[model samples]
Target: MARAEVREVVFRIRWRWVRLSAGVGAALGGLLLLWGYPQVQAVLVRSSSLRAEDVEATLARAPLLPSSTRAHLGVRYLYDPAIFDPPRALEHLRRAVRESPFDYRNWMHLGQGYEAVGDRARAEAAYRQAIAWAPEYFLPRWLYANFLLKHGERERALEAFARAARAHPEAAANIAELLQNEERVAQLARLVPEADVRARLCAFLLSRGALSAAVSLWRDLDWNEKAKLGLARIMIARGISTEHYALARALWCALGRRLSERAACSDDLVWNGGFELAPLREMVPALSLSTLGVSEEFAVPDRDFDWQIENEAGVMTRIAREEPYQGERALRIEFTRHENVRFSGVAQFVLLRPAATYEVCFAYKAEVRGDPRVVVEIVGARRGVPEENAVLFRWSLPREAGRAGWTLVREVFRTTPETSLALLRIRRVPADALADFVKGRLWFDAFSIHPIEDGVRPAEGEAL
Candidate 1:
C-alpha cells in the first residue's frame, strides 16, 4: 500500500476505537447514576419510616444531629405506643425544634407533639412559631386559640379566633359552631364592648342554661328589654318550682320594679308577693316583736366556753396548741389506722317555723396533718332527703397543717312542712386517714342559726 493510504487507514482505526471507548464509558456512567438514585431515595424513605428503636440507635450513633431531631424521632416512635411517653416525646419534640429552627412544619408538628406530650408552654411556643411562618394557615391559628382557651386566656383566644376567621372566612359556620360549643360568644359578651356581640352572647348563654350569667350580662349591656324580661320569666318559672323560690321571687321583684318604671305594673304585684317580708309580729309573735331580744354574735370564742377533744383514731396521743385560742383543747388525729375520720355533733336550737329558710353560720380553724376534707352536715327532720339536703353543704380543705383562722361557713336550709324536727351536724373527714384511721382534727365554733329573712350578719370586727 502507498504511504499516505497506510497512514489514513491507521488513523481511521484509532479514531473508531477512541469513539467506541468513549461511548461505552458514557453508557456505564448513565447506568451507575440510575442505580445510585434509588439507593439515595431508599435512605431517605428509611429515615422517614425509621422505627423508634432504629431512630434511637441512630441517635446513639450520631449525637451531633442536634437535640431537636432526636426529640422528633422520639415523639414519632411514642405516638402510638401502648403507653403514652410524654416526657420522652417532649424531649424529642424540643430537640427537633432546636435542631431545625426555620422549619415551619417542624414547628407545627413540634407544637402538636408537645401538646400530645403535655408540655403546654412549649406547645404554645411551637404553635406561635407556625402561625408566624404561615399567617394564613387556619389550622395553626385554630389550634393555638384552643390552647389559649384551655389555659383560660379567653381574650387571647378571641383574638386568635378573629385572626383565624379572617384567614378562613369560608370556615365561618364552623368557627361559629366552635364558638358556640366553647361558649365563646357568652364569654365575649362578658367583656366585649360591642352591642351586637353582647346580644349574641346573651342569646347563646340563655340557650345553654346559663340564665344567671346571661341575665347579668344583659343587665350590664342593656341590650334587650324583651330578652331581659324573658330571662327573668324563665328564671321565675324554673325557680318557683324548686327550693330556689326565694331567688326566683327576688328576680320577680326586680322585674316588677322595671315594669313599674315603664308603667307596666298592675295586679301582678300581689301574685309575685311571695317574696315580701312579713311583719315580725305575724312571722314570730312569740319573740315579742315590740322589743325583740336580738343579739349579734361574734366569731371569737368566749373565754368561759371550753372545747373538748374526741379522737376516734387511737394513734393520735398529743395535741398541739397554737396561738389565739392556745389553751383550748386541741384534737390530735392519727391517720395510721384509717384513711378518713368524721367529727360530728348536734347544736341546740328550736325551729319556730319549720317551713322557713334557716341560715347557719360558723367559723372553723383546721390544722390538717394529712389531707383534710371537712364536711359540715345538717340533718333536717326529713330523712333520705336527697344527698345535697341531707349534707346541707360541705367545705373541703387541703391536706396541710396550718391555722385556718376562723373561716366563716354558711349554709341555707329550706325547711318543709314535714320537717318538724331538725338537727345540725358538722363532719370533718381527713383525706389521708383510712375509713378506720382518723388522723386529723379540726376546730369548729361559733355555730348559730338565724332566719334568712333577717339577712346575713357581718363577720367579726365588721359592722352590718
Candidate 2:
C-alpha cells in the first residue's frame, strides 16, 4: 500500500514538471519570435520578398523595433516593382528622422527615401545631417560621399571617401574593389587621393596577375613590397622579364628588415641593399605622385627606411645626399669627435644558405682625423645576442689617411653549416674600443650582394 502511494505521488510530480517546462519553452519562443521581427523585414527587403502590407503586418505585431528599421521598411516599400509607394516611404522615413534626430542610420534611410522621390536637395540635406550627427562614424560619410559623387560633386566626394577610408580601413577594401576592375581604375585613380588606398589596390592588381594594369598603376605609384611580391611571385611562375627581374631584385633587397628570424633563402637577402630608398621625414601618406608631382629622388618608405641606422650613444646616420652610384641615395654615418662609440654605423641581418658562398660589395669614402679605418664584417649571430658573434670574414679598408677617393671593397665567403642567419655590420676601427680619441665621417654607397653559383663571374652587381 505504501509503495502504491509513492508511485502516485511520483506520477503527479512528473506531470507538473512537464507542464512547467512546456510553458517556459513557449514563453521563450514567443520572446525570440518577437526579437527577430526587425531583422525579418531587413532580410525580406534584401531578398525582394517583402511587400508593403507584409511590413505593415510586422510593425502591427511588434512596435519595439528601432526608428531606423521602420525608416528602412519605408525605403523597401519604395523599391517594390509592382505598385510601389515612394511618396509614402518619404513621409514615413521623414517622420522617423524627425522623431529620432540623433539616429544617423535613419537619416541615411531618409536620404534614400527622398532620393527615390527625386527630392535630391532634401536628400543632400538629410545626408549632410547624418554626417553632422556622427562625424567620426564611417557609414554616414561613406553614404554622403557616394551621394555627392552621383551629383557631380566629385572632388568633395573624393576627399570624403578618403576620410571614410581613414575613419575605417574596411571601407578601403570596397575602394580596392573599384580599383581592381580595370574599367574603374582610370576613373577612381583620377579621384581617390590616398596612398594607403592605392597601395592596397595595387597589391590586389599584382596579386591577380593583371601585369599590364598593375604596371600602369605602378608607374603612377611607388615602391610597395606586398605589390612587388605579387610581381615577384609572377616572376617565379612565368620566368622573369628583365623589367620584372629588376623590380624583384629591388624588393628582395628591401625585405632584409628583420634580423633575428631565420631568412628564407633567396637571391638577394639584403634590405635596401642598394640604398635607393629612404623615408620622407614627417609627411602624412597621400596619393601616388602618378599625378601628385612627388619627386622620385628617394627610397619610398613602406614603413621604416629599409636600411636602419644603428643608434649608439654617439652615432648618427642619414641618407647621403651626394655620391650615389645606384638609383639616387647612399648611407652617410657620422661619428662624434672625441666620443668613443663601440658600435656605430649601419647593420642588416640576412639569411644565407649554410655552406653556400655569398658576396658583399660596397663603395665607400671616408674623411677622418684619427686615421680610423672602416671595417665591414660578416658575423654569424642573430640580432640582440651579439655575444654569440662568430666572425665569418672581415674586410678592413684603410680610410684614406690623406686625401683618398672612394674605394670598392668586396668580401666573399661561404657560411658555416650552422650559420643560417648573419649580420652585415660596418663600423670604425677600434679606437673607441681602445679608449682613444676618434672622429670621422664615412659615406657608403652602391651596396649589393649576390649568391655565387659556381664561383666564376661576378654574381653581385658592380658597386660602381
Candidate 2 local lDDT, 1-464, one digit each (tens) = 45644444343468888999999999999998998776775645643445567667666665655676678767777776775789888877877887788998888888888888888999999898988888889988888878887887866776777777767654565755543466454445545555655655544554444555555555555445233333333322221222233343334433333221432324566755666645321222333323212223311222222344756666677776676656677777777755555664577655566788877778877667665666778787532233235887787756443344666766677888876556677876455356565577777776666788756555442323
Best by TM-score: 2
Model 1: what TM-score? 0.32
lDDT of 1 by residue, 1-464 (tens): 66654544343468888999999999999999998678555444544664566566666655665454565565565665653576776677667767777767678778877777677888898899999998988988988988887888878998887677567644433454567653565454444465434444444444445556656666765524334454455444334333343455466556555544432223221221111222111211121101111111211111100122234442343334433233343323334453545544322212224566666665556655544555555555322122345433345554453555656665666666655334444445444424433344455444555666645544442111
User: What is the C-alpha local distance difference test score of each model?
Assistant: 0.52, 0.61
How close is each model in CA RMSD to the real structure?
A: 23.9, 20.2
lDDT of 1 at 396: 54
Candidate 1, residue 239: how far the Cα is off, in Å: 25
Worst 10 residues of 1 by lDDT: 298-307
Candidate 1 global CA lDDT score: 0.52
TM-score, every prediction? 0.32, 0.40
